[model samples]
Target: MCDQCISTVAASAGSRRRRLWDLPHQCHCPLVGVCFPLSTLRQLVNKALGGKAMADDYEVHVGAVSECLQRNRLSELLQKDLESRYASTVQAFRAAKTTKELAGLWADAVRRGDVAGAFWAALTHPRCDEVLQEVVLRDMHMLQHQAGAAIRVDIGKFNLLLREHGVLARELGKAQQRCTQLLAEKSAEIEQLNSQLVQQRAATIGKETRIAFLLQDLQQLRASLPDYENTSRLRKQLEQLAHRQAELETQNAQLRQQLGQAQRALSLRGPEDAPALASEPQQDPIKEAPITLHLGKKTVLCVGGRNGNLAHYREVIERAGGQFAHHDGGLENHQGALDAVLGAADLVICQTGCISHNAYWRVKDFCKRHGKQCVFVENPSTSSLSRSLQQIAQVP
Candidate 1:
């Protein structure tokens, strides 16, 4: 019975020694470490109160662990779970943004676990804190660099879009200018076409008027055909009168021959008689005609004539005792001066073929308003001018 008691005491002492050291059952030996888990402190203290030998050993081990935990500031942090504490430290360290927050990263590492592992890792290892800090900083810098590169790419794309807009605007402006130019050209073409159409209409109206007048004259001639018997009697009378006119012309020629022979005989008798006979003026047919016209010192505006025939016109007009001025319509000089010349002239003569429509209307209006004579001639010749003068003189 005493042998059994001694064996049981030995077994209890061994178990108590293992519990005081808090050795993991998985540990190969009892000499590996002296620290206990902070979670097991209350149970160890209760067991430590039961015996004097274990109390001294437990106090020494726990006192050492408490001192380490305090030094690393892991005393409060050790109350939580190991995984929870590690996750909290890692999150705080990563969430740190400024230099002040990064300065506390060492403390976070020390508190990453209970005092045993945390104090040993931070205080025991030579370069562990520095390696962790370097890793975090490198990752942050990489993120920043990637963000900057993306922003630069966005700016480049925006600039390219702006350049494209400028090119498109320039092209649009050029197209607008081209459109304006084309519109002006089209408007001018339309205006020109309208002018041509108006001129054609005027010509058509004039032709229709001429045709009406011709038709009227034809009807009048057809109505006069019933008097053909009177026309035959008149034809017989014309033949008899023609014979009488020939006989009278022969008698007048004989009388002229006899008178010339007598005048020559009388002139051969004396120089005094010859002087008296020469002093008498010969009779001009134009001056002696029944319907003679003499434009003495009258101003004539000869509008629209050939410049080549100007000298001949002046000479002819001067011989007829008249002043002459001329205009070339609008072919050469300004036609504005023609109005002043027409205003000063007594007679206005226009060549229908050579004169412009503007000049013809101006002369016609001036003559009608001022009660002056105006004549329209087909040809701008000296003979035509002289015939017009003769016709105007017979207006009385």
Candidate 2:
């Protein structure tokens, strides 16, 4: 029973010390015979209850408190020293130090129905401290539990606010990025519009230039309208003149054939009619040449003649049994080709009026050096060249 009492006292005292004061929580006392010191325990109880006040009715409970302490083998520790201050003789009773002894004293006070005595007894003695500490600890635990619940609720609310802010920030970032993309697309569209505008301006400039040129041409055509009528009349007159010239050339060809037939008929009369024809009044001989031209297959170079009519001069010389080649007055033929033709010819017929002064001298000089015969034609006509060739043929 004594060992049991000590174990119970130590357990309850440990609980009160942990709950109420700054006592050593890890008690090293052996459970079988441990007796806690009342001297030090009373000091701890006074310190713990220093903030509490005793009422005037404490005087009436002093006798009951003293009786309980005496029955429990407890005694007051500072009886002599406290006699002067406290009106109650509380210092006279032995103090209960251990939890078991305080419990027994409390039970006895309650059995005697001394409620005031139990209250004062629990505060003043160490052994009764476990009874009072249980009530205080229970009230403190209830307040702490309420505070923890309020703090947890505030933390949860703050977390919800943070998550809402994070979501808003993400949405704002997406909106800004979308705005940037739209701005870039608009910039590209504007650049394309600018390029098209430039091309349109260039096309407009080209069209304006073409329209100006067409307007100028229209003005020139209108100014020349009178000249168009005059040119048409001249063109008709030129065509009529060309038809008259063709008719004249046909008549001249017929006359030439008649002359050729008359000459042939006169020649057919032969030597029997030659003396009679000579005895009569002398008429111009029908043949221009009295005798045949005696050019023995020799080439004659005609230098510097009228360009288109050179064929007439060539035909005249060739009909008189001579070969003919002509230069276009040195304007159309090279000087070396003229020189070569002049060197190979047996005679040179130079139309001095048609040739340049230099060409006349060149032909004269070439004939003088090469011992070739040269004849000068002042007027380059077929009749003049025929007469010159006729006079030469009549030479002995």
* lDDT tens readout by residue for model 1, 197-287: 9999999999999999999998888687854444554465456457666777898999999999998888678776777778999886675
TM-score for each candidate, following the candidate numbering: 0.31, 0.29
> For candidate 1, what is the TM-score?
0.31
On TM-score, the leading prediction is 1
Q: Write one digit per residue (lDDT tens) for candidate 2, span 159-203.
A: 998899899999999999999999999999999999999999999
lDDT at 276 for candidate 2?
95
Residue pairs with colliding backbones in model 1 are none
What lDDT is reached at residue 69 by model 1?
24
Q: What is the Å distance of residue 300 in model 2 from its true position? A: 0.8
List runs of model 1 lying over 4 Å from the truth.
Answer: 1-291
